[model samples]
Target: MKRISNLLIAFVAIEHILFLIMEMFLWQTPFVIQRFNMTEQIAKDSALLAMNQGLYNGFLAAGLIWSLLIRSYVEQAFKIKLFFLSCVVIAGIFGALTVKISILVIQALPALIGLVVVYLSKPQENYDVVI
Candidate 1:
């Protein structure tokens, strides 16, 4: 279960990283345009906004990676994971509400699952520190 959680978290991180790339660098491409269902001119007009959004996505990926590097069966680690996953979920929901419903499925759902998995991924009692 823990392994699955870790993988899910990593997957979310990777997805967001791709989002960063797409929004930051490829926003004007035909493929990217189709993904967002925007016309070429609209894509051009929104390029700056998309780049800003991409930067935020990059930050989210960085947070998730930071959480992974704090490898310990400690409450702090759990809190970090939960916090970042929550950020992803919230951002996803906001994007879905304001931008596109597909954001919920493409961005938020994995984080939501990661949140549940992280909650249950706590190590055994033996691994808990008493100090």
Candidate 2:
């Protein structure tokens, strides 16, 4: 289970990193337009907004990495994941209602699964105190 969670977290982190680059840097480029079906003009106009959104995605990835660390505030790691995943879940629902059904599956489902795994896994409390 731990292995699965780790793999999922790693995958999500890497995937979102690429998304961050695409949305922030290559948004107006042909790659994202061809893939996500957005117009180049719109992508260019929204670059800054997309970059902001990408930062949130990066935060989610960071939270996952933090949970993997053994230092204090490990519990805060889970809290961060849960908070962001919950936001994704709500956004998914809104997307399903207003934008498109695919975003729900593509964006939200994996996040939900990852959050569930992180929530179910017991936190590692073992730590050495150096004097």
Candidate 3:
């Protein structure tokens, strides 16, 4: 369960990294334009905003990676992961509401699942600490 949870977390982190790349560096590319279903004019108009959004995505990825690196302090690691995963879920939900519904499935769902898995994988005695 721990391994599975970690893998899911990693997957979410990687997805955000890709999002960072796409929104920041490739917002004007034909591939990104098609993937986002944006006209060239729209893409160009929104390039700066997309880059800012992408920087936030990069921060999310960084936080998740930081959580993964805290191996010695289990409780601290769990807390960090919970916070970042919750942020991802909330961000995804917001994006879905404001931008596109696909954001729910693509961004939130995996993090939600990962959150559950991570919670489940926690040691039974650690429940008190988490609460």
Model 3 TM-score is 0.94
Tens digit of per-residue lDDT, candidate 1, span 18-68: 999999999999999998789999999999999999999999999888888
- Segments in model 2 whose C-alpha atoms lie over 4 Å from true places: 71-81, 95-98, 123-131
lDDT score, candidate 1, position 29: 98
- Ranking of models by lDDT: 3, 1, 2
Per-candidate TM vs. native?
Answer: 0.90, 0.73, 0.94
Better of 1 and 3 by TM-score: 3
Per model, state how many residue pairs clash.
Answer: 0, 0, 0
10 in model 1: Cα distance from truth in Å?
0.2
**Model 2 lowest lDDT segment of ten:** 122-131
Error of 1 at 28 (Å): 0.5
Question: Clashing residue pairs in candidate 2, if any?
Answer: none
lDDT of each: 0.88, 0.69, 0.93
Q: Which window of 10 residues has the lowest lDDT sum in candidate 3?
A: 122-131
| Winner of 1 and 3 under lDDT | 3
